[model samples]
Each structure stands twice: as structure tokens, then as C-alpha cells.
Target: MTETFTVTVEPLEREVECRADQPILDACLRAGVWLPHACTHGTCGTCKVEVLDGDVEHNDASDFALMEFERNEGKTLTCVATPTSDVIIEADVEVEEGVVHHPVQDFAGRLVSIEDVARQTRRLVIDLDREMAFNPGQYVTIEVPGTDATRTYSMANPPSEPGRIELQIRRTPGGLATDGWIFKDLGAGETLRLSGPYGRFFLREARTAPAILIGGGTGLAPLKSIVRHVLEGGLAHRLYLYQGARMQADLYDVDFFRGLEADHPEQFTYRPCLSDEEWDGPHGLVTDVVDADFPTCRKHMAYLCGPPPMVEAALKTLMRKRLFPRDIYREDFFDASDKATGGVRSPLLKA
Candidate 1:
């Protein structure tokens, strides 16, 4: 058996046994340490931590995420680093009063159904053995059948439905999880091993400002969760959702959101933008459309999710429109392919 090493988490002063090959972030989160992380596959630098003592093996971390200079300076991506000896790591730990930090847990899920939602996207409905407590915008890592590889997808359904969740997945041309499995022979009633409530991309309820949610393609998954949460809980803040897609065929659930807008006409607004084709709503990039709609986004909270290009574009637009960086939250949906191409972000936008 491989020996386990003791990992001491700073500030919390807690110790946990980490398997020889386990990522430091995994060990910490499973131990309820809750280190801030996004895109847990090591492409995003959100899990970067300082190793105060001992050594670690940085495995498969993107050079952009954990640069050579940073590696030499004792910085490592906890999601890809494994402790080679007993060590202590100082993680960025913050506390927000209204946010609930749900402990991560594993569950066996049964695929209930999957149907084409858009041209290259599918909506997957999964039923878990037990309820999973996760904040809106959090995701789960699912172990691919017939392989040890895992893929993370955000829960599109709100937290109210704890035992069941919905996911909006866009098929990647030759992705291991997409083309290799999820879009292949995978069928209903198949058993899937998953673990979650990962990522800090959830709603920030403490702020009372109106929310501007922007999502590109399948990135709408988590934003759907936040919208449902607000509408269900009867939250007072107004919500504006902007969905960006290439064309009408790339858009899904347009009627569903229209129905929601009809129900809450005074509180919710949905804008669907199609860049490649003409549409009744908007005709340009989602960020450009939003920039035109809201001349100034003073005191408004922004939630952005999508490919790095879209997310960064929205961030720039929001900041330029006078939204504070502290009020803008974003989650970049990075795949392994992005690691090589690189999408290194400013540490100031770290969240």
C-alpha cells in the first residue's frame, strides 16, 4: 500500500492524511478545508498555494497557471500538486457571512435521461442516491465510464432539487469525456461515480445589487441555477440574464426562459444574443449588447460564465461600465486543451 503523508493547512492549523498520489486540493477539500478553486484540472490558477515547508510534485499543472518562476518561488497549483513529504501550505481562505460553504461529498448517480438541447449540446438529468448540498454555480466531477478520467459540469438545476440535478453539456469534438464517452454509447440508467459541490462560483447573496448574469453556450448551466434560486427564494434583487450563442440552432430552452420572464415580468429579464445569425433580440456579441443596454452598471453585481474569451470580454465591459472588481464574479470553463493554448488571467480577477 502506498504510504500517506500528513498535510498541515495553515491558519486553520488542521492536518489530514493525503494519499501518495492525491492532489493537495482534493485532500484539503475532502477534509472540509474548502480552499478556493475553479477548473480543478490545473488550468486555472485559483488553487495556487504557497508551500511553507517540505516538497511537492507538481503534476500536469499548466505552465501559465503555475509558472516556472512561481514554482521556483514555492508557489504550486494545489489541484495538480502532490506532497512528496509531510508539508504545510498557506491557502487563500476568506469568509463571507451569508455564503454557506457546503462540504464536498461523493455519490452514485443514475442517468435518468439525456436529450438534445441544442445543435451540439445535450441536457443530462441525473438522480443521486442522496441529496447533494451545493451552492448555485458549483459543479461536480464525474468519473468517466471505462476510464479513470473525470469531467466537471455545473449543476443547472437549483439547490431545491437536492436529489436530482440537470447539466447542459456541449460536445467537444474529440474530448475524452465528450466525444469519447458522454456523446458516445452512454445511455440512460447508467451508473456514474461523482463528487462535488466544488468551485467558488456561487451566488453572492450578501450584496443587494441587481444581478447581471452572462453565459456563453453551455456555460448557462450555473447561471440557470442562480436564476432559479433567486426566483424560488423570492429574493428582492432584480436579475438580468444574457445568453450568447452562435445562432438560433445553438440556443436552447428559449421558451423555458421566456415562460420564466412572463411569470416574473417585473423582476426578471432575458436577452438572447446570436452573433452568427440575425435575431429579434440582439445581433452582436453578448458583451457588446450588454454594454449598449446598460450604459453604466453602477452598484450592480455581475456573474459571468463561459469560454475564457467571452468571460474576459464581459469582465472588461463590466469594469469599464463602473462595476467594481469585487462585485464581479466569473467562472471560466477550461478544458485540458485550453491549458496548452493558455488563457492566463490577471491575479486581480482571482475569485
Candidate 2:
């Protein structure tokens, strides 16, 4: 028999059973209690909860998410922690009134196609067994068959299409998932298991401010979804998309983005930037480009998704332009450093 413990959630006054081998957040989701979470691997710190009593063990939490002070204050990341005993936790537990909270569902999907759009980036489209509904900027965690490991990728396409989702994955040289499985062996018609519609990085409805969407490398995936969502809804907020790459060839999906701009010329603006190589268009870091264009971002809502360094630099630039922390939403998917921190960066392996 498997060891199991009860988790008591305060404020909501709910209780759920967690297996010894599974994270607490997973248990909560399995019980249909949708707690907010971004990176379920413990890098993002979005699923933090205060332990009111009992003991919890950190399985694979990163220092970035669970700091020493936070740990001392009885805080734990539910996504990476399994309870050693029956525990009581305090967390922000509320379901949006009108929004349907889609609990995590096991989905089987066959790889429809994988085409190289850039030198090291591949665009993959999968047709699922059943229709999956997700908001813009949500991601799915795919189970690597024959292993306990899983990899996450944000949706590059919107939910306008039923039973399908697109992803743009950057090649990770020797990664277990990217190189070992996805690159070396994954083939069309191969069935894969995935679960989610995870993350709180989606677009906020009923916004009147102009939106600025920034992306780097494979981070363009979620931004692509956001842009398409806005366009499809015929929302009239001025939208600016700034996609940055190290070299010219690193840029992809230019024709599609250009087509969006052409259709909504007055509302949409596309700016593709290059940092390492000299380009006739914009030639600088993405943060520098944003600094030059929007000197004052008092009335702007910024959404950024990219490597950690790029997202950090852009955050500073946005703050300098007078944008409040609440006005700027970010999803830092990768760590660009050579450190073995598990992130979306190339060769980013999770132990």
C-alpha cells in the first residue's frame, strides 16, 4: 500500500489526500482545487503556501523559489514539496467567478508534425485525443514515455482551434527531453502523454491600456498565443510585439506576425530586433529597443516571456518607464547561465 497523508487547506476549508511520492499541488489539482502555479518544477515560486502545522519535505525546489527566510517562516512550495505528515497550509485559494477552472487532465496526443523554423528551433503541432481548452499563455507538461521525467512547453497557438495546440521548442544540445527524446527519437504519429493548462501567465481581460508583448528565443510561443487571442477577439487595445534574437537567422515566424500587422495596421505593430548581429531594422538588446520606443509606459501593460537575463533586463526597463509592478506580467522560462539550474535554456536538464 502507498503512504498517504491529508492536507488541510485553510481559508477554503478543504482537505485533500496526497501520496508520499506526489507533490501537494498535484494532489490538490487532482481533487479539483485549482491553486495558482506557474512553473510546477519549483523555479517560479507561484505555488507557495504557508505551512500552518506538520512537516513537509522539499523534493526538488530551487533556491530562487524557496529562500532561507521563507523556509524559516513556515513557507513551502506545494508544487515540489510532499508532506511527511498530515499538514495544514494557508494559501490563496479562490476560483474566478465566471471562469471555468479546468482541472489537470491526462491527455494523449499524437505528434502531428515537427518542422524546423529556425536553425535550432522546431515548431511542433499535436492533435490531442480530446478537445483541450486553455487561455492564452498557459503551458502543458509532457510526460517522457518510459521515464518519470516530464518537460514543459507553452502553447504557441490560441485555443481557437479545438483538439490541437502548437509549440516552438528550442534545441537543447544534450538534454534528456530535447536531445535524447524529442530530437533524437520522437516521430510523427507517436503518441505522447501530457497534463495541464497550467500557469497564471495569461492575458487579463477588460484592460484599457496599450499592451506591450516582449519575447526572446523560444519564449515567442506564449506571446504568439496572446497576440492571436487579442486579434481573434477583435479587441482594440494597441498591441506592440517585440521579438528579439541573437542573430538574424534566430528569428522565425516573421511572415505570420507581419500578416497580423498588415491586417490590424492601426492596432498592431511588430518589431523584430537582433543583438549580436547588425541588422538594418532595430539593432540592439530588446531592453534597449523598448527604452528607445516607449520612454514613458505609464499607460502601458507589459507582458514579457523569455530567458531570465532578458526578462530581468526588460523588467528594469519597464519599471524605468514608470510602469508599476502590477502592470507588468512576466514568465521567465529559462535560465541563460551555465549553472545546472533546471530551466528552459538549452541543455537545461532537471534532476
Candidate 3:
């Protein structure tokens, strides 16, 4: 027999049944309730909540954003906590309503092509028989055939067009999905299963401030989609794209971004930086470049997508320069292989 428990979530008075082994956040997701979360593995503190009344069993998720005092007061990270009995919890979590869009049609798609963009990064284009509508910055979970493993990748393609999606994947040594399947032996016409257009990392149309986009390595995947959408929409806000790589070889699609900047000189600027390269162009870390160029970030809206280290560094730099956390958006790309190889470390969790 499967163990089940009832969970009452306050502020919305929503109740849902959760399996004894399932995390509260996963239950909420299945129940069609949206919650603010990043790095679902007990880090980033985006899913912290207070337990008003209930008996629950959960491992310490100090890394998930809960202070010791809060944890002592019955606070828990919903993504890692499992209820032992009927429970009531209170949170200020934002729940997205309506059906979520996905890039794969009904969780199935065929890999139509894979193009090498760099030495370690490749762009995989998958074609689906049916349309998969998704916001540009949202990502999908791909399950490679013949394995129980899965990996999440942001769709480089925009939602305005459907029936196909593009993903830029970075190969990690010993990564089962990235190194084993995607990078080594995966080929065209292969079938892959996918789910979700999940993530709250998409660009917000409400802000009209001059925008700053920061991306590192393959994190440029979603940033590219946002820039394309902004350019295509012809939004009048001034936009600047700052992409950082260790060397010039890691930077891809320079001509595409250059064309965008040329077409909209008054509204767009593209700056590619090589942190450790011998180039005469912009040098040093990407956030450092942002700091030197724009000292006051108060009037700017920033969208950051990248590795945890770069994201944390950029966040600190932005906050120090007067940009509000609410005005900044980010997507933390978690390495799924860490779960398998025990090598993935989240900076947010450490904080």
C-alpha cells in the first residue's frame, strides 16, 4: 500500500494529497500549483515555507534558504521536505495558473539534427510532430532513451514559432546525459522524451528600463532567445548583452548578435568578453565589465542565466550597485550529473 498524506497550503487555502516519499513542491506541481523555486535540491531558498500545524519529517535543508531560527520555528524547504502526516503550511509563494507550455509534443520528439557550435558545446535541434508552445526562457526535461536519467535544457528557440526547439548543451566529463548520450553517441533521427516548459526565468514585459543581459558559457542559450524576442518585437527599451567565456573559441553566434546590434544601433549593444583569453577586447569577468560600464544599476533590469558561481557573483555586483533583487531575473542551471557523480556543488546551497 502507498502512504498518502493531506497538505493544506495557506494564503490560497489549497489542499492536495502527497505521497509520503514525495517532496511538497513536487506534490504542488502535480496539483497544478506554481511556486517560486530555483535549484530544487534544497538550495537558493526560493522554496522556503513555514509549517503552521503539522508533523513532518525532513532532512536539514539549511542550503535551501532556511535560517537556523526559522528551521527551529518549524520552517522547511518544500522541495526537500516530506510530510509525515496531515499538515498545514504558510508561504508567500507565487503560483502560476493555467496549463504550462512545453517544447516537446506530448513528451516525445525526434532529434533531427545536431550542429557543433564549439569544441565543448553543441546545438541540438529537435523536431516534433505537434506544436509545443513555451516562453522563450523556459526549459524542458529530456529523458534519453534506455535510461532512467534526465537532463534539463532551456529552449533556445522562441515560443512565437512552434513544432521545433533548439538546445545548446555543454559537455561535462563523465556526465551520463551530457557526455555519454548527448555529446558522444547521440545522432540525428534519434527519439528523445521530454516534459515541461517549466521555469519562471523568462523576461518580464512589465519593466521598461534599459535591460542588461548576462550569460556565461552555454547559459547563453536562453539569453539568446530573450534577445531575439526583444529584437523581433521591436521594443524601444535600450538593451545590452554581455556574454562571458574563458576564450574566444567558447563564444558562438557572434555574427548573429552583431547583426542585431547593427540593425538597432540606438536600442541594442552586444559585448562579448573573454575572461582568460589573450584578446584585446573586453577582458576580466563579465560582471566586472558590467560594473565598469554602468556604475549605477538602479535604472536597469537585468536577466542573468548561467552557472551558479557566475550568477551569484553577478547578483552581488548588481545589488551593490543599487539594483533591486526584484528587478533582476535569473535561471540557475543545475548540473544533473552531480546527483549521479557527487561532484555538483551549488553556490546557493553553500550560502
10 residues in a row with least lDDT, candidate 1? 342-351
What are the per-residue Cα lDDT tens digits for candidate 1 across 276-325? 99868799999999999998999799999988889999999999999988
| Candidates 2 and 3 compared by TM-score, better number | 2
Error of 1 at 137 (Å): 0.8
Please report the TM-score between candidate 1 and the true structure: 0.97
Ranking by lDDT: 1, 2, 3
Model 2, 157-198: lDDT tens digits are: 887875898999988877768877787778888898998788
TM-score of each: 0.97, 0.91, 0.83
lDDT of each: 0.90, 0.83, 0.79
Q: Report how far off residue 31 is in candidate 3 (Å).
A: 3.7
Clashes of each: 0, 0, 0
Model 1, global lDDT: 0.90
Clashing pairs in 3: none
Tens-digit lDDT string for candidate 3 (34-111): 665666556556678889998777663543256667778898888779999999998786544543533222457889
